[model samples]
Target: KGISADVINIHTIKPLDAEAIIKSVKKTGCVVTAEEHNFLGGLGESVARTLAENNPAPQEFVATQDTFGESGTPEQLFEKYGLNSEAILKAAEKVIKRK
Candidate 1:
């Protein structure tokens, strides 16, 4: 496979890197956001908003669904919420299928 991936890190979400997001999504035709926060009103929302305004594409999110949290180690939380590398890979596979 000669596919190239376009990866961008938005460290500050107060002001999303919309230009970079649009540019990358335009090239890849899909997106997968992995965030360690609640899926609602998180980076996923910002990304959805950006795509809604600019270029929309099939997207998958690797984040915890909106719900109560329990005490656990970082690894446990990640494993429970499907935020690990396997989760990202699964999300990528899913989004690519939609494309």
Candidate 2:
């Protein structure tokens, strides 16, 4: 867990900061996109496409798999959907290994 990471907080997906993403990946050589939305058509996908076209790198997505929501507290929901810090850490570790 001693790895250094650059965090980019994108406000919108439509105007996704591809430049920021590319710049970060250029420095880190890998990326982990953590989003509360669906992994299929969310920021992760956009970032993946951007990376794939411009600067490809090892990438991991920490998002809700294409699954329906269930009744639960926020903590439980986040844990079940892999939207927690631990999930991000796991994803980051996985991506770094691929780098």
Candidate 3:
């Protein structure tokens, strides 16, 4: 939480800002993309593809993996679908360690 942050708000999804995302990944050399949707065909995958094609960096996806959502409180849903901070951290670590 104390780390410096440079946030970029992407309001448009139909026409994603691939260049911006690619540039950000190039600068950081790592990325953690989070979304409420499923991992497949989601923003995380889009970011990963962009980075892969442009800069090829360590990218992590924090989203529901090939699963459907359940009706419950936000926290409950996250816990049930493994979309919590711990999962995100684990994904980041995995991506970073990938060869």
Candidate 4:
């Protein structure tokens, strides 16, 4: 309950801030990337590739699975895709254990 975290938002994908990502992971020893899109080719993959090339560490992804979205309220969509705070907390816990 007393863990420290740093959040970084990558606005664009073509030129991902790998340096910043690596630096943060270097200090924290792990990472979790949450995005609205699928994890396959989304932020998770970018972070994973960056870490794999540079400072490798355990990472978790809180993104939508490989499935199509259905029409619903924003809250419902977020909850269904596991794109909420609870998912982030769970992912953080898992990644920390790996670290």
Q: What TM-score would every model get versus the actual structure?
A: 0.91, 0.95, 0.77, 0.96
Where does model 4 exceed 4 Å of error?
none
lDDT of 1 by residue, 6-55 (tens): 77888988889999999999889999999998999999889999999999
Candidate 4 colliding pairs: none
* Candidate 3 Cα misplacement greater than 4 A, ranges: 1-8
Q: How high a TM-score does candidate 3 get?
A: 0.77
Ranking by lDDT: 2, 4, 1, 3
Tens-digit lDDT string for candidate 2 (1-99): 698999999889998899999999999999999988989999999999999999989999999999987999989999899899989999999999999
Error of 1 at 26 (Å): 0.9
Clashing pairs in 2: none
Ranking by TM-score: 4, 2, 1, 3
lDDT of 3 by residue, 71-94 (tens): 999999888787887887776667
lDDT of 4: 0.93
Give the C-alpha miss distance for residue 12 in model 4, angstroms: 1.0
| Candidate 1 clashing pairs, residues 3+ apart or interchain | none
Q: Candidate 3: what lDDT?
A: 0.74
Indicate which candidate wins on TM-score.
Answer: 4
List residue ranges in candidate 1 displaced over 4 A.
1-4
Estimate the lDDT of model 2: 0.93
Q: Model 4, residue 54: what's the lDDT?
A: 97
